[model samples]
Target: MEDSDDFLRLILDSIAENIAVIDEGGGIRFVNHSWSQFGSDNACSITQDWSKMNYLSVCDSAALAGDEFGMLAGNGIKSVIDQKEAYFNLEYPCHSNNEQRWFIMRVSPFELNKERFFVISHQDVTERKLAEKAVEKLARRDGLTNIYNRRAFDEILSEQWQQCLTLKQPISLAVIDLDHFKLLNDTYGHQIGDDCLIAVSALLKNFARRTGDVCARYGGEEFAVIWSYTTLLEALVLSKALLEEIRQLKIPNERSPIAPYMTASIGLVEMTPNRILETRDLIAQADDLLYQAKESGRNKVSSLIVVPSSAVENQN
Candidate 1:
């Protein structure tokens, strides 16, 4: 029995996991090389008691709960250990070199002579996680302006629409068109016009960073943003901010009639859950407002706020 036990221990310890044997009294009796390595470099030995380690609480909780506690030990880790089942592919973010790093953890429980034991393994998966995230971002991002792509916009819109339907929240949509973008291209060359587009995109992006905001390039010289759960007044504020931000760019629009430099026309439309508003209708209304801004004079913002009346009222 002793030979068999020693052989088994040798084999299990050889595997890449922090393996430790706990006696019936719940004290750590043995810790393999892998287990010792999990401790801080300043620590002298693994049998020095688990409570002395900085991460003891994290490890203990994960051992008790099947839930996914984070690397710092929360409900997640506890879920796995409490169930006495195997856990795999658990991911959590860590800070290394002042940057985010990801780790994949696996934990399993074992027993010997009625004593409880556990094996834990953690692998650095930062590179793989970053690659996967980058791919997802590229798939959902517009190449030109680095805004969310139309595909992402569609997904967000559909999700928000469903949410608004259920929660009866308000959703606002805006369509913005660059004023005389073709004229700018003709006067400054297409390359310079592209630069202007990039600059304008940056300004719009800054505003869209707010909660429940999403922005996308709807195609050439045109961009769109959807604000979920936003009031009409809030939507109007963003619209005004967007127009002013573009004007501040000072792209030297010597050819523009509305201003000495480049400018944009923005149209905003808000829909409430009480109203039956389709995404297409919301877009069309905002587009109509954009045209209104152009008609009145470019470089201005016009909002079409939906109300109890059948007719639309204009807000600047």
Candidate 2:
């Protein structure tokens, strides 16, 4: 029995992850060498004679402190100890002053001589977590302007639509188009055109300050903004401000009649939950209004608030 215990401790010390064994009573039975080193390296105030510290008590303290993740951890640990769950796993950030870190906590229950014990392991997963974040960032962002991509914008619109449906709030969308952009592109070559697109995208992105606000490349020389919880007048004012900001860019477009510098037009629609559910209709309406902006002469904004009674009744 003694030799077996020594072998187990030796194996635990060899591994990297911090490992500890806690009994059913929540008493810390044992902690491996790596566990002590982790606390020392992180300047954790937890003592080496971990028996003096109760894992369950730490979780309870965290929960009382109103840490959501800590509450989850406490619940997960209880589930394992009660044999209600096979194992508990949680990935969480534990950044310290010296280093940004993330860890994967795993708790598995085992029985020896009819006595229950839970093996807790903490594995450093910072590199993997950071890499995953980088990949996710790339997936959701536009390559050109480093703003949300069209796909992300669509996702946000769908989410906001659902929220508005439930809360009966208003959401607005604005379609922005560069006037005579094709002429500018044809005259100055694609490089300058690309520069203009980047600059304009940056400007539009800056306008998305509010939560759930999304600015995306709708298509070539065109951008779109989804503004959640906005009224018709608010949408119109924002669109007009965006139009003015684009003109202020002052990128010369001699080929256009609107101005010596570049200009953009905006078409906006503010819809409430008591309106049609067809997001496509909203886009089409905005597009039609954008055509009107171009026809009425560029460098302007056009907006409308619409409600389809039939859809509103269905929604109700």
Candidate 3:
């Protein structure tokens, strides 16, 4: 029996995953060698004597401090111990100061000497998670300019609209159209036109540095910008500056009647969200204003603020 116990311990200690066994009351009864190594690597103070501690108590303390993963882990372990669940698993991030890391925690029940115990194991899965993130980013990006594609733009606009509505903050939208783009493409080849688009997209990136700001390729020669928690006056000021900067790029467009260099028209709109309004309504208003700007002059900005009828009546 002594030799059998030592053989079992040797096998458990050789496995790479961190493994621990806890009794019915959640008291840590055994831990493999990898468990001690993991604790030391993470700078855990209690690694020296894990058998003297209650695993559930540690999870409960972390839960009280508002660690969401701790709460989830504690509940999952309890479900297994109570026989309500045959197995349980959870994937969570456990990033260290020097590197990002992810792990999958699993719990399973076992019978030992007429008593029930749970075996917990944690396995590293950071590589898989990072690959998934890279794939998602590629799906959301435009092929030509490398900015966000139209599909991503629509999704992001809807998300930002809801967030701004919930926070009772203002949201702004800007629709931009390059002036006489077809003429430029006709004069210089499609290659130069593509280069111009890339340059403009790069410039747009600078304006979207704030959190919740998004710049996307709406379509050929068209782009859209969403600004969360911004007012009409603020968006208008930025729109005017964007026009000036595009002109400064001095991408020659001798064929354009409006100017010797390339320019753009912008339609800007701002609104404090309400239940009666939808995201499409905001896009429609901006599109109409953009058309008006093109009709009046090719290189200018037209802006409007949308307010609820009740608010307008109160002001009157």
Candidate 4:
């Protein structure tokens, strides 16, 4: 029996993935050779003497400490241990400060010596995760400007609208159009027009670097941006500074009447969504503002504030 136990331990260690056995009480009963080594390699603090650790407590504690990944893992494992589920599997990011890494955690229950125990395994899945992320990014980004495509922009904005509405947070939206884009394209040809769009996209990307800010290529010669949790007063200040920065870029547009260099007209809208309002309301208002800007002067800003009916006059 002793020799057989030694052979079983050897066989378990021979497998590459990190493996551990937890008793019904949720205490670590055994760990294969790769377990501690993998923990050490990944900078996990729990590597030393893992057998003495209470695995479930560690996970629960981490979850309580605000680790989202740990919370998912704790719930999944608890479900299996309680016999509510036969198996559990989770893929999660475990990236350190230096290198990106992903791993899959698999937990299963088994009978050992007339008692139930769990076998947990951790397998590196960084390559597959990274590949999926790359594909997702390509599908979301525009081919021409390298910013978000119209489809992604629509989906993202709709989601943000719902989120802000639920949270009762302020949201700002802006639509920007290159002044005299058609004439500029006709004069300089499509190549130069594309170049101008790319340059403008870069500047918009730079301007929307705030947390929860999104910038996207809305359509040909048109762009849009959104700032979550921002009021009209704040957005107006940012827009003024942004337009000044863009004007300073000095990208030549000979056919543009707004300036000898490229210039843009902006339409801005700010709202704190309520049950009575719809996401399209913001878009329509911003589009109106953009039209008014162009009508008043080619390179100016027009804005509208959307608030509750009672507060409408105050906003105006």
Candidate 5:
């Protein structure tokens, strides 16, 4: 009987699935060698109890069990504890060797001690998940500026509005226009004009170094930036600095009818909390400010503040 038990153990250990025998009470009774080698505990589970393992704490069994993937794995361990049949697929994201990966898991129930136990199996599926994400990113990103496209910008701004309202945070919007851009195109030709756009796009991205900050080309010779969790003063300072940087571009616009150098004008506005401002209203305010900067004189920055239910007001 001892030799027969040892032979059975060897066969179970040789199979890929992590074979672990647990009592009806959810304790780690026995673990196969294969199971011990690949489980996510970093080899800390050789002599450790399953209840004490760190990986189980963060496991989202509820989310996994109800989804299609989870259904394939069988009832989750939770069901097993309740003496009910369960299955699930557990996706574990792991970081190792400076790379990230996901392990697809299968968990099911079995009989042990005349009660109920569970079996969990997993396989690495990081490559598939990464490929899907890569495809999604390529679809969402703009080919020219590498920023979010207008469609993405529109959707994200709407989402940001809700987030700001919920968090009671401030939001800001800005409109940027190239000074004498038409003449630059006529003189330097469209090729150099496109280059100018790329350069300015890079500048805007550099200035918007926050998680919720978004920059995009609104259209020809024009761009827009959305700033979340920022104040009017912060937005104004950023616009001023960016305007100055573009003024100093010195792109050799000698062939243009305007200034000998290339430059841009900026207009921005901040949305305070508790105000009911629409995205269009924010955009219109920035556009009006852009015109104000252009009318006052080219190559400068102008900003305005608009109360949700009131008219536009000038900010110092």
Candidate 6:
């Protein structure tokens, strides 16, 4: 019987997942080698001996300290222990200072000698999670410029619009078009035009360093930027700076008119979102302003603030 128990322990230790068993009262009953190793590697407080610890108490402490995953894991384990749930599973991030990591925790209940126990296992799922993120990024990124694509731009704009609406903050959008880009492509091969787009996209990325800022390839030689919590005046300042930076790139545009170097025209709009207005209205207004910039001689910013009808009526 002792040899048989030793063999079972060896098999459990050989498994890669961190496994542990707890009694009905959540008292740690046993833990496999992987569980001990993981605790030691992570410098966990429970590395010395888990038998003296209560698993549910650890989760409760984490919950009190504002760990949502802890609260969820505690509830899941309790449901399984109470026989209300046959099994429980959760996926969560547990990133370390050195690298990002993900793990899936699974809990299953069992009975031995008429005593109920719960077996919990945590499996690393970082590789699969990273692969999923890679695929999602490719779907949202432009192949040529390596910037967010038009679809991503639309999604980001709509999301930011909703957030700004909920916060009652201002959101800004910029519609930028390269001046005479078709002529530039026609004059100096498509390769040069592609290179120019790459350079401009790289520059635009610098301005979008903020949490809610997004720069995307709108389509062709056009690009869009979404600035959360920004007013029209603030957007105009940045738009003018962007224009100068693009001109500073000095990508030769010896095709026809407008400076000897490449230049761009921008249409900028800022608005405090309201139920009466849609995201499309913001785009439309910015597109119109962009047209105005082009018509008024390219390489400048035309900006406006869109006031909802209710706000205008309230002002009167």
Please tell me which model should have the higher lDDT, number 1 or number 2: 2
* Model 6 score (lDDT): 0.91
Answer with 4 or 6, whichever has the higher lDDT.
Answer: 6
Model 4, residue 62: distance off in Å is 2.6
**Candidate 5 structure quality by residue, lDDT tens digits, 32-94:** 776677655564433545554423322345346554433433336556556554565667665
lDDT accuracy of residue 206 in candidate 5: 89
Ranking by TM-score: 3, 6, 4, 2, 5, 1
Worst 10 residues of 1 by lDDT: 67-76
lDDT of 1: 0.74
Backbone clashes in candidate 3 total 0
- Candidate 3 Cα misplacement greater than 4 A, ranges: 1-3, 310-316
Please list the residue runs of candidate 5 whose C-alpha ends up more than 4 Å from where it truly belongs after superposition: 1-25, 39-76, 79-86, 90-92, 96-99, 109-117, 155-163, 180-182, 254-258, 273-275, 278-280, 291-298
**lDDT scores in order:** 0.74, 0.84, 0.91, 0.85, 0.73, 0.91
Tens-digit lDDT track of model 1 for 118-160: 4556666778999999999999988888998788887888788
Candidate 3 accuracy as TM-score: 0.93
TM-score of 1: 0.65
Winner by TM-score? 3
Better of 3 and 4 by lDDT: 3
What is the per-residue lDDT of model 4 for residues 94-130, given as tens digits with 9 covering 90 to 100? 8888889999999999996899999999998998988
Where does model 2 exceed 4 Å of error? 1-11, 37-45, 60-66, 95-100, 159-169, 210-212, 257-261, 273-285, 307-316
**lDDT score, residue 17, model 1?**
56
lDDT of 3 by residue, 180-209 (tens): 999889999999999999999998998888
Error of 3 at 163 (Å): 2.7
TM-score of each: 0.65, 0.80, 0.93, 0.84, 0.72, 0.90
Give candidate 5's whole-model lDDT: 0.73
